[model samples]
Target: MSIKSVPLPDIGNFKDLPVIEVLVAAGDTVEAEQSLITLESDKATMEIPAPFAGTIQKVLLKVGDTVNVGDLIVEMSTQDNEATQKPAESAPAPAAAPTPPPVVDAPARSTTAEPASPPIPPTPPSTAAPVNAPTLGASAHASPSVRAFARTLGVDLSQIAGSGPKGRIQKSDVTAFVKQALTAPAHSAPATGGSIPPLPTIDFSQFGAIETIPLSRIQKRSGKHLSTCWLNIPHVTQFDETDITELEAFRQSLKARADKMGVKLTPLVFILKAVARALADFPRFNAALDASGENLILKKYIHIGVAVDTPNGLVVPVVQNVDQKGIFALAADLAALSARARDGKLTPEDMSGGCFSISSLGGIGGTQFTPIVNGPEVAILGVSRSKMSPVWNGSAFEPRLMLPLALSYDHRVIDGAEGARFITALSRSLADLRELIV
Candidate 1:
């Protein structure tokens, strides 16, 4: 048997990645491609895999160690010539490091038997600063991912002691710090002039039995994003009902053809096509405010995001060039994206570059509800369940299928008049199929 050293592979441009977990120990036999260690970067969590089957002789790295490409991770005993040849062949290839999957709502696996450290005392909101700020101290023990997360919430890592092994900061520690800061006494120093006052905490368990359920990772991430958008954007929601009688009839006619083509044709596909047309007519609706917030960047391409409710949480997967696709094509893309979202197989790329978003509650059932504007994108369209209603067309009342729509936009980017016009145009496109072509 030959002892071989396993080094970190080429994992893109990332460096100084923190080893969050070591999956195997010395004397542990591992299979080829089995994960040996998990490294957390600013963007995602990655697991380094064993190049070839071998028995680990020694672990060179431990949790909290910062690693880079070619950094030695472990020393292992390989059985044959094939094991020796595998590293030489795989080390140079970029594919040696597989793409990290989307972060799921799961707890990190601990390597040691040490009890979890107690929660750190909450720091005053006024003292909160970026993790890299000098006030946080250079010796702060946190992975790049934790630093990035703290940066988002404007938390100083140095103030709060870490709860992870060896005093390394974890994401949960950051969250707990923020939660405590937000729930502090109302008289506490405010971070800004317009800072929100703290809400009173009550012990509900005194009156009734209660179960404390932790929010999933996806929920926590999305909640943070939504809170940011809500606080920063001046939101204006316009509620309207669109007559989809013709559209529904048209969809029913194509149901047979859609089934033959092996795609489920849904009203959402029609709504997508209509929204794409409306976006073309109203360029501002499809534009985003630049970082400076002084200029609007109009996208030449139309990529719309559809919010899919998965078992874990809600995810919005973007459909590229929505203005360029047909109804059947849109239906297929929606089906595939939704399926992947439910199965937790969606990648970051699948959920990026959205010019606008649509949240449809029609499948489940809701009369009307406002969807928060997914920032970076100026507007989001919310669709609710449709019902038959009586409407007068100049003289006699006729029964028509009406779909409720709530259009919420960033008031800083879109005015009241423009918001009305955009939703009106969208309603017209859905009312008549030919209007989409026009």
Candidate 2:
């Protein structure tokens, strides 16, 4: 009996250390170094490596479990082939479909040879499975939320394919299935009574002249959390605008490589990079709150949040260890997170935890707006719109693109003067863009 151990690899981000899914189960056959389990840290997902050639004899962890470096993920039996079930071999080819007796309208046949690879064998279905009686109108097993999602998209999971845990329908899987069913050939009817519930009509009589639409699930939660942060934490505000000609030019120079990496080298992403850089010297800015009422809270890691505006609402997704990642990699992650935000797909975990926040409308070149500090974060940097404007060039006005930056900080933890100075440092960092790449 040869026993092989599966050790967890050093996944890059700490946030992703939570094990989301374990791919292989006991008695399951996995190739050497195949993905054994999946762990998500820092919103980035990575897979654990199989330690050796083996049969998975045991799985030590489950989903939502947290793990660390050098932890034992699983154990496997690395016995020789003869000691275990014989490896399945590719099957031989079936004879080409014989041409029907040549009809008058039959097309001509070619003499080309088929590939020599052997045919595959039919897979045996799982042995231990329960057979349930099918329901008529709809499945009672599905949750109300899942059913509502399916109804919203006009999806019938019975006709559409299911790509979810244990084949249970997921929201995304349902949405994709609906899209496929739309383009599919002559459709089959789903269990009858499948329809979208109508939206409730609004009643305006209860409120005064002005009434705002209620927030979404994500927005409502964000509002409550940020409100608590506002009440307990004393916040100070400071505003500054910088002429970022050099930063704008430098970003343009890296456009090709940035695009290839799927990184959007926006002035905002640059500002984030600088904020992280500056925090290295100013430990006071990179900290958390201790509303526990005894002592102030400080963090050892410098995670920064880049606030993203989506259809659902504003979400500030943190980029963990901003100082560790290069500008290009951070830019790529920013793009990926923005896509997640716009889709309203970010999980609760995505919106939590950050040392600092940066919000920017500079992509559209708007004047300036104060960005509320994401709760628990000490500072939020607001980036204004960048545009070609007149700047004094040796007494002559020259038209050049300049980015306006607005800096907002918590007054309780950070001083007004210090906040202004921090923004000043950020502006110099942006104007002196050379420091970023190195």
Candidate 3:
């Protein structure tokens, strides 16, 4: 038998992942593709698997040790095919044929092209078997991606109820869990104040009969997410009103063309285009804070999410590649996505990957309102009812269509000055269509 070393596989851009668990000990027999150790990063957890079957000669890593791709994991004593063949020399030539099958079967079982590699198990020995954490008391039924996401947030998967296939945990499940944790009310008192007493639970039944209607699933989920955004993010709302008098006239001019294209182009479409341009001018608004909270992830592609109000709750369907698509294309996408959202037909994919969000209450009656910043996204635009207001044009005062704009952004990522600049740029785009065209 000969000894062979197993090194960690490529984990992609992640450096210095800390070892969370060691599955095998020295002298323990392990099979090929079996998990040997688990590494956890800020965003996800991953496992190092055995390359080939062998008895572990030396376990090079332990829990809490930091590791990276290509780092040595274990020294394993594997069967030497040449040494095994030495015994075949004394036997008949026919024995050599059977010996080749074991060697062939060994490689075939361990290294199949399909499932090309082993599942990168992302838990330590205490939670061995990524699919089933027997040691953890109850199994967390979740997809690999969901598992990694849960670990990234340091959530206990066993505590969350799955709302997916066969009760499998989904990405939304992990997100919901984190949001709940962030928003869940604190039972403790304030650090500066004395212990505050809890509010008394009222029993209204003593006076009159009351009926309880539970909130819809969507409402409950959204409420938690909104609460998280409100408490965790330091939001600064930059309020400004844009003069859309000329822009509205231009949009009306295209009414016939828009109708011929089988789409109704509304003011929101023009606003979408303006937001995309502003994002291009200010790339920080198009970025998100990484899981570590130390790095910024600036997205090159611009996808905007439009908040739609449904009977069930609020849903944000994303319009992809806003920077690349024209107003007409955006009109079509918005029409399709909003209709689907209202009909409760919007899939999970329809609501993912939004660099920015817009919540417009213009159709209803609202002068101004604050909208929470969507998690993972740094900013959101709130649009309210437009009204005719007198504006001074340097020479005289004239009635102009003024649209209320509330720009809420993460104070950590954006400063008050940058916020002012973003809103100013957006206001300019609306005031002068030529600037947007240029």
Best by lDDT: 1
Question: Model 2: per-residue lDDT, tens digit, 305-364?
Answer: 777776656666667788898788887778877777676445434545678888777655
Q: Against the correct fold, how does model 2 do in TM-score?
A: 0.52
Q: Give all candidates' CA lDDT scores.
A: 0.74, 0.59, 0.70
Per-residue lDDT over 200-319 for candidate 3, one digit per residue giving the tens place of the 0 to 100 score: 559989999999899864565466456546656789999999999999999999999999999989899999999999999999999988766789999999999888887776777789
lDDT value for model 3? 0.70
Residue 176 displacement (Å), model 1: 19
Q: Write the per-residue lDDT of candidate 1 for residues 1-438, one digit (tens) a residue.
A: 788899887766655666778899999999888888876542234667788998999999888677778889899898767555244234221111111112222122344333333443344655454322222232477665566566666565666788888787787887788778768764555444224433456999999999999975566557655655766678999999999999999999998999999999999999998999889989999898886679999999999998888666777878989889898999999998888677755644566678999999998998999899887788999999999999999999999999999999999889999999999998988898898766
Please rank every candidate by TM-score, starting with the best. 1, 3, 2
| Ranking, lDDT, top scorer first | 1, 3, 2
TM-score of candidate 1 versus the correct structure, residues matched by position = 0.72
Task: Please list all clashing residue pairs in model 3, or write none if there are none.
Answer: none
Comparing candidate 1 with candidate 2, which one achieves the higher lDDT? 1
RMSD of 2: 20.0
User: If scored against the real structure, what TM-score would every candidate get?
Assistant: 0.72, 0.52, 0.58
